[model samples]
Target: MMHGRDDALDALRISDAEAQAVLRELDSVQPALPGGDGRRHRRYAYYVPGGVGLQIQGVSQTYLVRPRNISRGGIAFLHGLYLYKGTPCTLVLKTRGGERLLARGVVQQCRCVRGRIHEVRVRFVEEVDVELFVDTFAQAGDAESGPGYDGGQMLDVLDKLRDAVEDGASLDEVRKSVARLARMVAPRAPAQP
Candidate 1:
């Protein structure tokens, strides 16, 4: 068993040169964004499952990931089983709150730092709808159904919104529906003076 484990480790290891190249590429493409919350809102734990589609040089690939922790800056996946450093991919997260947030990022680093699981770090390369994603997911969690909100339901809502706008439904109607859905999933806090 020990020998098998050693073999697996060796297979997963990346050479130093490869690591450096990956870091260099990431630095060159990473965008300028505030790194999460500097002080008070340091970090937040969120469990959201999503799909990451990679279209690298026309070779398309997709990976399933469950975001373990997310901040304004970036997201960390619990395990990088099939992901590697330097992997450029588009992350599409279907938050529990019925919002689909898209982000362009490259895998900056990944390693099995502790235990046998790997931690994958991605650096954002474009603007992300952090507010909508965060708010929606928070609302979904508070729903009676709990955190296991259906992704299909969210997609259906988006399709309806699109159809409503395309079919010439008034903007006010769309807005009201969106607000109603949000409130149904999660009630908003009272405004401060």
Candidate 2:
């Protein structure tokens, strides 16, 4: 789902085929020696459909980006414009719980892949736990101590709520969204033993 202003994101929006092709290429290209990939940490494919907030240091403008992959040390995202190397940036990644995780980093690489779209890599100043952004099943004593819920579903509902509010939907429509959110947060009944 493209979640930004149509005029702004249309040019940068890439089809699933394009995104997957880039990922496939990365996967097939194995480095001759360990660390030869120039990546300090292993990268995990992050194709989740969402717009990440990109704030360049000393710049007031915040652009939307489509992320491709993530790692403990950094992240790679597709943007419409070419950002200069060494330019500091912060990626605001929204969590399933509607919280934002700020990743501070500097642009390490920005290569044009397709028309008007560039793959930008940013190296974070500090390492981050990959689990924060990626949804994973929680084990016993895990920070997220419960059964995993569908992050996509949550994003969908939140989007609905946002649209309803922004469009000035009637009270009934707002109420319906509230109810849906309530049901999602409500505890489920235990299965019969």
Candidate 3:
């Protein structure tokens, strides 16, 4: 069984170089806001600090996480539970703009900072998800299941499609995505006689 952050990193098979990289990614903790409550002390700058959900392995319930910092590779957040290193978990980050970013990753590092709160680092499994994590744009047409579904999801999907095309997604892949989008927008379209 792993003991501390180092042991956890070892179990994850992360190289010294990778560990160093992750460590450097973390910036110095920030000071508290003036005249604000002392309980709301922020440590680091985060892309989407709070509003992140994490469900432990084999646990049905998901808990909210207070993120510390974010990087292209992974994120370090404050977790209330004792999540061991090398444990598999699902991460859900909701952008300030209200877009959802979901991904699966292993607990690369965990350390007990406070009495019960532990800072946990999770490295994403997919590179594509990492790229999309920072900028999540949902399918506007599929925002809700109903008529007159006017939302930004459609615009987001189009932007993603354009990016995929530029990034060299196969013609077949683009076709499939377009077809899916068409199906999503069908309900909103005027019915033909």
Q: Which of the two, 1 or 3, has more lDDT?
A: 3
Residue 5 lDDT, candidate 1, scale 0-100:
14
Question: What overall lDDT goes with each candidate model?
Answer: 0.49, 0.66, 0.54
| Residue pairs clashing, model 1 | 97-136
TM-scores, all candidates, are 0.43, 0.56, 0.47
Question: Which pairs of residues have clashing backbones in candidate 3?
Answer: 139-153, 140-153, 140-154
lDDT of 1: 0.49
- In candidate 2, stretches whose alpha carbon ends up further than 4 angstroms from where it belongs are 1-38, 135-193
Ranking by lDDT: 2, 3, 1
Global Cα RMSD, each model:
12.9, 12.0, 14.9
**Candidate 2 local lDDT, 1-193, one digit each (tens):** 1122222333366665776666566547732112336656655556555457787787656777777777668888888889999998888776556666788999999999767878898999988756567632221112244433345444656887899899999999889877766655555555455
lDDT of 2: 0.66
TM-score of 1: 0.43
Superposed model 1: Cα runs more than 4 Å off: 1-42, 49-59, 82-84, 113-116, 136-193
Q: Which prediction has the highest TM-score against the true structure?
A: 2
Residue-level error in angstroms, candidate 3, position 83:
1.1
Model 1 lDDT, residue 2, Cα? 12
